[model samples]
Target: MSKIQHFAFLLVEEFSHLAFSCAVEPLRIANLVSGRTLYDWSFGSENGATATCSNGSVTLVHYGFDAIPKCQQLFALSGIHMRNHVSKPLLAALRRERARGTRIGALCSGAWVLAEAGFLKGMQAAIHWEYHDSFMEGFPEVNLVRSVFVADEKHMTASGGTATADLMLHLIERDHGYDLAVAVADQMVYNAVRNATAEQKVSLQSRNGMRNRHLARAIQMMHDHVSDPISPALIAEDIGISTRQLERLFGKYLNTSPKKYSMEMRLERARNLLIQTESSVTDVALSCGFDSPGHFSRVYKAAFNVTPMLQRGRID
Candidate 1:
């Protein structure tokens, strides 16, 4: 049998409950399925106060940063306005653990904190898709990938949700065996388990409920050019499809026009920036490809029923 592994999850305020639950539960089931104490886990907070998640749920920690114990590994779990929660103290604690030879990793947007501490310089990391734009803009030294997770690349990083479960399963498989990992997954009823290299979101074929490669490529292009968005016609041409065919593809599966999808994508990015950064509404508008604040305001208000100004300070 492999040695028992101890893990610590350091929770930042506004962390994702889904990510946290998915992370801890997989380990629990690994023990249950294996019928051995294969893993142990604990939670910590930056302050003694309970860490509140993005969904407004609270989790009591075993201790604060001052009390984090030596473990086989540690993962920082955070989401939403993660920029607000990262502190020098937390970074120092993580660095101390790394120096002691603990494997450090991140769940969800926690990569932002690691990058802030210079732990991710020149390392390929993954954050939740929502944070990709701001993270790249802020930390140019970190190589950010769109994968759901990256395992054991100096430091592991998972984009969160079920991706956390996948990472834990990968560890279980490596340390224990593939059969044990499959047993743990069976207990969780989590079929279709993904590997670390899988992309963050559901595959477009399954998610869009279709198998149109052209449509998928077109939408991916839209996501890639949030700020400097290309027209739907350009995307279609790039994908080797006529504009009309692309429009039909979008209409059939997404129930929206390509232009509308692109607009919503840009608006969603705008919202993320406004919440996660101190950028002014004008800057957010420009960064999201709006020609002017006035145009962005009108579009934003139409879609979300509130002006960009009102949404600027809102988190999550």
Candidate 2:
């Protein structure tokens, strides 16, 4: 028989209850169907005892950071405000655990903690789409992918919500078999088992809730040419709108000016590239549409308040 895989889920404040349930339920059903405990799991928290999830539900944690159990895998589960919750002690504990050869993983914004703990250096990771911008600003060295999840060697990360279920199912398949993983999914009525290449969030059509073809094309142009971005005036011209009109449209709809939004979008892409790619800082700057590395550095430092070299060191 294969050895059981013990998983320790480290819960954080405002954790994603849905992701937690999605991760654990599959393991539970797997054992129930196979009539064996192929997966053993427990919960832990920094403070010990209980943690309130984003939905206002409370989960009782069985262990604290100081008393973490011997487990094959440790996944930190978190949701909103992950940056605010990361303390020096928590990062130190994670670093200590990692030094002991314990495999580390994260779900949702939990990647933020892993990044802060200096564990995601030169590692490909995934975070929820909503926080992708903030995460890039916070940890520029870690390679951030748009995929639903990334599993490399002993490390695993998922872009929370239902993606957590897919990640756990992948683990189950690795431990048990594909048939067992499928059975667990069937039991859970989970139709979508997103692969590693699958994106974390829905398409722009769903996100924008708009059917305007010109706006869609403009947005696509911006996304496609993130590194060499076109000017807002150019985008307006292509979409047959005056620059002033375009600014008004974006301000009315997106609550921001077109130029500012485009700059933000480019910076966001730059942040992701910095974390996910090994390109030189100059290369990263050029790729992100910044003609001068000095300018890029100034803006990047203003946004993240850290030099790119230091950020890279944190991830490496």
Candidate 2, run of 10 with poorest lDDT: 307-316
Angstrom error at residue 299, model 2? 38
* TM, every model: 0.66, 0.67
In model 1, the Cα lDDT at residue 314 comes to 26
Which model scores highest in TM-score?
2
Q: Write the per-residue lDDT of candidate 1 for residues 99-141, one digit (tens) a residue.
A: 8888899999999989987899999998887676577779878
* lDDT, residue 195, candidate 1: 57
Model 2: residue 37 alpha-carbon error in angstroms: 0.7
| Residue lDDT tens for model 2, 242-278 | 8887777665434456676667677666666676678
Provide the overall lDDT of each model, using Cα atoms, as 2-decimal numbers: 0.83, 0.79
Which TM-score value belongs to model 2? 0.67
Error of 2 at 291 (Å): 38
Model 1 CA deviation exceeding 4 Å by range:
202-217, 220-316
